[model samples]
Target: MRAPLLCALLLLAGLQACVQAFYLPGVAPQDFKRKDVIYLKVNKLSSIKNQLPYEYYSLPYCRPEKIVQSAENLGEVLRGDRIENSLYQIQMRVDEQCKVLCRIDALSGAQTKAFKAKIEDDYRVNMILDNLPVAMVKMRKDEKSNSLVKLYERGFPVGFTATTSGGQPEVKFFLHNHLRFTILYHKDEITDLARIVGFEVEPFSVKHTYETPWDKVSPTLNTCNPGRATFVTHDMPPQPVKEGEEVIFTYDVRFVASDIRWASRWDTYLLMIDDQIHWFSIINSVMIVLFLTGMVAMIIVRTLHRDITKYNQLESGEDAQEETGWKLVHGDVFRPPANASLLATFVGTGVQLFGMAMVTMLFALLGFLSPANRGGLMTAMLMMFVFMGLFAGYFSARLYKSFRGEEWKKTTMRTALLFPGVCFGIFFCLNILIWGQKSSGAVPFGTLFALCFLWFGISVPLVFIGSYFGYKKPAPEDPVRTNKIPRQIPDQPWYMNPVFSCLVGGVLPFGAVFIELFFILTSMWLHQFYYLFGFLTLVFIILLVTCAEITIVLCYFQLCSEDYHWWWRAYFTSGSSALYLFAYSAFYFYSKLDITKTVPMLMYFGYMSMISIGFFCLTGTMGFYACYIFVRQIYGAVKID
Candidate 1:
C-alpha cells in the first residue's frame, strides 16, 4: 500500500513538471471570418520612450475576413487580446491630373462632437500629442504566404507625415497634429448665448514610411528602393469645417508587405535569443556549480570528519585543558542576538518571498503562466504573495518566541508591514510621478485602491490568523542550551571579518545567475519577449544550491574561528548578492539603455530597488535556514558533557 502511494506521488510530480499550457493555433487569413464588418481599433499613442491612451472616433475599417480570437483568460486578455473594430465611414478616389489619390471620411455631427469632447477632456491625449502620434497596424498570417506560423503579427506603430505643396518640401503637420481640432463658437444676438460653431482639418499632402525586415532573397538590396515598394505620397488631408459642418477625413491607403516569413507569429520575439549566447551562459553556470560542489564535498568528507574524530577522542583531562575551536563556544552558540525582533521579522518576510517565488516559478514552469498569457506572471505573483502572508506571520511569530521575545503582537505587525510597506511606499510615490506625467504606464486610482484593499483586507487578516495559530504552539527547542553569560567572540583574521566574508560569499551566487539576469533585464526593459521558462527554472535550482552550499561552508569556518555571531552574518552573506545585482543594473542602464529623461530614470531605479529588496529577502532566508540546519547537525553529532 505504501509503495503504491509513493509511486502515485512520484508520477504526479513528474507529470506536473512536464505540463504545458495550451495555445490555440491561429487561423489562416483566407479562412478567417469577420463578423460582417471590421473597425480600425485605436491603440495608445507612443513616442520613442513613453505611451498614453487616447480617445478617438471608432472609424469603420476594412480587413480580410477571419475569426478573431476572444480572450479566454485574464492573462491572455492582459497580453493584448482586446483588439476591437471601429465604425467610421471612409471613401477613397484617385485624381488623373497629378495621379494623386485621396481618402474622404464621412462622419456624423454627433459622433464628431463626442470624439472631440473626449479628446479635449482627457489629459492623456494632450500628453500623447506633446510627444507625437505613432499609429500601429495589426497583421496576421496570410493564407497565401506559405508560412507555417505568423511572424511580426503585432508590432509598434509607424509615424505619419504630411508635406507642404511648395517646391522646397517641408512637413506641414505630422499625424500627431493631424488629429487635433480648433473650434470656433458663434453667439446668437437675440438670445445672447454662445454655442459651438464648427471644426475643420488643416489640409496638407501626406506620406508614410515603414521599416521592413531584410528580405532573405534580396538581402543586399538598398533600403531606398521606391520601385520595389508601393509609395502613397501626394495625398491630401481633410478640409476644415465648422461645428455644424460635416466633412470627410480621407487617407489614400497603400500597404507594402515585406518578404519576411513567419513559421509562427510568436516566434518573432524569440528569434532574438541567440543560440550561441544561451549555450555559453548555460556552460558558464555549470562550471560555477561544479566548483562550489567540489568545495562543499571537501568540507563535509575531509575537514568535518577530521574535526569530529579528533574532538570525540580527546581524554577527559585534555578536553578540559585544551578547549579551543567551536566546542569552546557550545554554550553560547544558540544565544539569541541583539534586536532579535528585527532579525525575526526579516527572516519571516524572506520566507514569504521565497515561497512566493518558488510557487510562481513552478506554475510558470508547468505552463500555467506562459508569456503568451500576457500579465500572467505578475498576476500570479501578486496573488501568491497575498496568500503567502499566512506563512510570513507564522514563521515570524515562531522565530520571535524561540528568541524568548514577549512582544508577540508587535512582532506580528512588523512582520506584516516592514518590507511590504517600504516597497508599496516607493511604488506609490513613483506612480504619482507617472500620473503627473500623464503616461499610460501610471496605475489608475481605482487600481491603487484595489492593491491597498488586497494588502490590508486580504493579506493582513490572513497574517493575523496565522500568527494566532503560531502563538498557540510551543516555541522550537534549541539543540544546545544557552549560557547565562554569552561567550566573548575571539578576534578573527582579516579575511574572516564580516565585511570581507559577506563580500566573498555573495560572489559565487551572483556569478551563477548573472548571465540569466541579463536576459531577464532585456526582456523587461527592451520590450523583448522572454519565453524560456525551462531554462529559467534550471537556473533557479542552481542558484538555490549555490546559496545553500556557500552559506554552510562560511558558517563552518566562522564556527571554527570560535565566532558564534553567525545569526546576522549568515543572512547578510547571502543577501549581499542583491547589492551586486543593483550594481549590475546600474552598469546595464549606463551601457545598454538609451534613456535620458528624468522621470524614466527615476522610475527605472525605483523599480530596481523593489526587485533588489525582494531578492535580498529570498536569498537571506535561504542562507539563514541552511546555516541553522548545519549548526544543529554538527552540534548534535558531538558528545557534549
Candidate 2:
C-alpha cells in the first residue's frame, strides 16, 4: 500500500508541474481597439398581410471572424466596389417538428440553388428570411468583427442553458457570440404613442407608438411587399412584446466562434465590445482585493504583535508550565503527524507552498502581474517555491532541533526535498499518460525541460539556503528544562486521537470549494468558458481561513490531550484538506461530468491529483504555522533556567 501510494502521489505531482508549465494564456488585451461589424438573423413569418408590422429587438454583440471579413471587404470596396462580396452565410436546419418545410425539403437541392440566386440579387449584403418585414442589417464589413463587443464589455459569459419538455427533458445550450437584431415598422404609426411604445392591436399582436432617430420604418416594409402600397423602413430596434398567452415574436440568437481565443487572436481585425458584466467583475475584484488585504494586514500585525509580546515577558526558572499559553505541553510537541507518513510529507510540503501562493496573489492584486500573461502562474510559482525552500529548510531544522532528535540532519534533508520530489515524480508520470493519448492537454517535451531547469536552477538552491537559515534561527528558546526522563502520556479515547481531529479539520475548506469545482471541471474538460475569477478569488480566501481555523482548533485539542509530538500532527491536521479535495473531485466526476471513456477518467484523476497537491500544501502550511506560533508562545512564557 505504501509503495503504490507513493507511486500515485509522485505521478500526480509531475502532471501538475507540467500543467503549471504549459497551460496557455487566458486573458484579454490591455489596449482598447474598436472594430465594428454588422449582425443579422432570420425567421419564418406565419402571415404577411397588407403592411406587415415587425419589431426587432436589437442588442449589441461582436463576432471576430465577421469583423475580419468586413474589413477585407471594405478594403476591396475602397480600392473600388468592383468586387461583389459574399458578406454573410446562413445554414438552416429544419428539425422533426417543422412539418410545413417538408415540401421544400423534398426539392432541397433545387430550393437551395434558387435560394442562393435570390439572395444574391435581392438580399445583397444581408439576407432576408422567408417573407418577414425584418431585414438583417450590414453593420460593418471587416475581417475582424467587433460583434460580441457589447457582451464582452458586459463581462457576462455569453452562454445560457435552456430547458424544454420532451419525453423526459431536453437542454439546449446557447453561446451568444454573434447575432444582433433589426426592426421594421410603418412610418405612419412611428410617431403615434400606441405605435412607438407599442400597444396590443390584437390579443397576439402589437403596433409601434413612437419614433426615434435610429428608427427607420419604410425600407423594411418595402422589402417584404415590393410593388404593394406599403412604406419601407431602414433601421428599427427589436421591441419587447408581452401579451396574454401568445408567443407572437420570439427569436433565439447564437454566436459561433472558431476557437475560444477568437477575440485576441485576430487583434485589430476582430474585437468584442466590452460587456457590462466584465466591467462589474473588474470593479468587484478591485474592491475585494482592497478589503481582504486590509483585513489580513490588520490581523497579522495587531493580533500577532500582542501575542508575541505576551509570550516573551513571562518570568523564567519558575512554574511557567502552569501558564495557559501553547508552551504548557512542551513534551507533546514532536508527535508523529496524523494519518499516514505520506500525508505528513504533503503537509510539510504545503507549508512552503502556502507562502508562495499568498505572495503571488498579493502581487497580482497589486497589478504587477495579471492572469493574461501566459505561463505567468508557472513562472511565479516556480520563483515562489525556490524562495519557499528556505522556509522549509528553516522550519524543518527548528522542529527537528525542538524534537531533540539525533537524526536532525536526515530530518532536515527529507523536509527540504523529499515531498517536492514526490510531487514532481507524480506529475511526470501523469504527463506520460497524457502524452500517450495524444491529447492537446498534454505538456510538450520542451515545456517539461523548462520546468526541470526552473526547479533545479531556482528551487533547489533556495531550499539549501533556507535550511541553513532555519538551522541558524535557534531552537525555540525552551523556557523550562526538559526532565531527564520523558513523561508518560495518559491514554485517551479514540475521539481525542490526532487521527480523528485531523480528519475533522478537512471539512470546512472542502465545503467552500465543492460547487466551484464543478464549473472548473467544465472549463477544463467540456471547453466551457469560466470568467468567475472574482468568485474563485473569494473562495480561495475563504478556503485559506477555514483551513487555518479548523487546523488550529484541532491542534489545540490534540495539545490539550497531552500529545507532545505535534510537529507532524499540526502538519497533517490541516493537510487532510487534500483528502476532502480529492473526495470532492471524485464526486464532481461521477455526478457532474458527462465523461464517457477511460481516457477522460484517467485525465480527470491525473489533473485532480495536481489540485490535491496544491491544497495539501496550502492547508498544511496554515496548520503548521498556527501550531508553531502557539507552541512558541506557550514555551516562551514559561519559566526556564
Candidate 3:
C-alpha cells in the first residue's frame, strides 16, 4: 500500500507539471488576426486611508458590457476574465487631429432615471482616476529602477476655462497635456491596443489677452496622474442639465507605433525577488538545523549510550538490578492514549495535510506552479488535498486499530470531516461578509455548490475506500507490551511539564520560518506580488526538519524523566507555532496595515485563523511521526524477558 501510494503521488505530480508546461507559450510568436471588438474590465476601487474596496460597476450611469457568452462557468468570472464591450460606441481612430469623433446624449429618460436611482443608493461615480483598463502589455525593462513599468492606457486631462464674453459665463475646454501612444503587434496583424510609455502631468495655466478691453484671469488646474496617465473628473463640479439641455465633452486621442510583441505580456507582472533576504533566511534556518542536529546527536551518543552500558553492566554483574529511567516505564510507554480514536483521526488528517503540502511545494519548486498561471496555486492545492483523502483515512484507521479501537466507522468519518469542516465553515462566513460588501472577491453561489460537490463526490468516497482497505488488515504488533494496569506517573519538573515544553519547542520551528513569514504576510495584506517559490520551498523543508528534530529531542527528555504521556505533548510541541503565528498576525495588522474598515479587518483575522489551523496540522503531524519513530527504535532495540 505504501509503495503504491508513493508511486501514485509521484505520477500525479509529474502529470501536473506536464500539463502546466504544455500551457506555457512558445518562444516564437504565432500570427493571428486582431478581433475588432474590445472589452472593458472593472476592478475594486479603494482609498489610501480607509483601504476598503467597493464595487466599481455598481452605478447605472456607466453600464458595463454584460457577459453574453458562456454564463454557466462561475470559475471564469471569479478569475476576472469576464469582459464586456463599452456602452459608448466610439470608433478607434489613429490620427493627430483633435476632432469631434462621437457625441453621446447626456439624457436618455429611462437610463437617466436609473442613474438617479443608483445615485440615491450611494453608488460611486465612474471616475477615470480609479478605473484601470483590462489590457495586458509587455513592458520594456528600465535600468534606472531595475523594474518593469506597466505600459498602461493614457487619458488626457481636461480643464475648463470660463470667461464673460457677452455678460454671461462662457466655459471653454482645454487639453492640459498630450499623450503619445504605441501600437503593438499580435502575430501577423496589428492590435488596436495602444500602449502609453511616457506622460507628463505638471500644473500649468494658459492665459489669453484679447485686443478689446477685457479682464482675464486663469486659475491653475493641477492634473493628477495615477502611474497609468489616467485622469479623474471627480473634482469637477456637477453640471445640472434641465429638460433638453445639451452638454458636450470633447476628448483628444493619440496613437504611436512600437515593435514589441504580445507573446511576452507575462513578463510585465514578474516581480524580482530580493536575493539577500532569501539567502539570510536560508542561513538562519540552516544554523537552527545544525543546532538541532547537535542536540539529537548528544542524546543518542552520550545519554542513550551511558544508560545502555550501565544496564548491561548491572545485568552481567553478580547482583542484577532493575532498569531505571526510560527503561523503567517501558510497560506503560506503549499504552493507548485516552480518547485514542480522536487522536488517531487528528493524526490521520494531519498526515494528509503534510502530504498535500509536500507535494504542492515540490511542484512549485520545479516551476510547475507560477503566478503567470492564474489560479494555479489554489487549484493545485485543492486537488492535491482532495486526492490525499486516502492517506487521511488509511492512517487514521490503522492508528485507531493499533490502539485497540473498535469504532472504525466513526473514526473514519471524523477523519474525513473534522478539520475540513472547520475550514469550510470559516470560509463560508468570510464569503458572506464579502457578499454583503458587494466585492468581486466573493465566490458565487454556483462556485460554492461546485466546491461542495468536489468535497462530497470525490474526496469523501476516496476516504471510505482507504478506510475499508485499512480495516481489512490486522492491527500492528507493538515491541513493548502494554501493561494490563496503568502505571502511576510521577510529578514532573516545571520545564518538563507538557505545556511549558510545548511552548518552548514551538519557538524553534516558528523561528526557522518567521523571516519568510514577513514576506508572505506582506504579499497577502499589502497586495504585493510574491513569486519566490524556490525560497519558500526551501523554508518549508527547513521548518519540517526543525519540527521533527525538536519534537524528537523533547520527547526523549520527557521519557527520560519517566513521563509516559508523550502523545499529546509531541503533537502540541510543534503545533503551538500556530499560536505564535496568530500573535504575529495581530502585531502585523496593527503596525503594517492601514485598513480602518471593520469588514476588511474581520476578514483578515478570519482567513488568518484558517491558515494557522492548517499550519498547526502540518507541523504537528511531522513532530508526532518523528517522536513515534524515535520511541519505537530505542524501545525495540532493548531486549525484554
- Global CA lDDT of candidate 2, please? 0.45
Query: Where is model 3 more than 4 Å wrong at Cα?
Result: 1-55, 59-65, 68-268, 312-323
**Top model number, TM-score:** 3
Over 1-641, each residue of candidate 2 has an lDDT whose tens digit, in order, gives 65335434543554354344333222322221112132233211111110111111111111123332211111111111121112232222111110110001022344334323222222111122221112222234443563432111111122334466868786443322222322211222243211111001101111222222312222222212224532223232212211121111112222222222323322211122223434454445445445544554554466445645655575565544545534445554544333333343344466677777776666556543432232344455665665566566556566555554545456555765676677677767766765565433355576667667756765565555555565666665554555555656668779977778778766655655666665666555442334445556666776666655555556556665666666666777767878988887888777766555565466568668877877777777776776677666555554433
lDDT of 3 by residue, 88-187 (tens): 3212333222222122244556534433333332222212210122222335576678987654322222222334488777543332222222223333
Which candidate leads in lDDT? Answer: 3
In model 1, the runs with Cα more than 4 Å from the true position are 1-31, 34-40, 46-154, 157-265
C-alpha positional error of residue 116 in candidate 1 after TM-score superposition, expressed in Å: 20
Model 1 score (lDDT): 0.61
Consecutive 10-residue window with the lowest summed lDDT within model 1:
124-133
RMSD of 1: 14.0
**Per-residue lDDT tens digits of candidate 1, residues 1-641?**
65335434543542342232233222221111212121233333323243223222222122224524333332333222233323321111111111112222343566445344333322122111111112122235445566554222123322233466769986421221123122222434465333322222222323322234523333222211245653323243333322443232222222122232322323443555665676687788888888878988898899888777877885779556776778778898888888889988999899889878888888877766544444567666776777677788888888888888988888888988888899999988987887687555667676677678868976776677677777768987887788898778878999999999999999888898998999999877765567788788788888888888889989888998999999999999988999999999999998987667788788889889999999888888888888888888888777777
Model 3: clashing residue pairs?
181-256
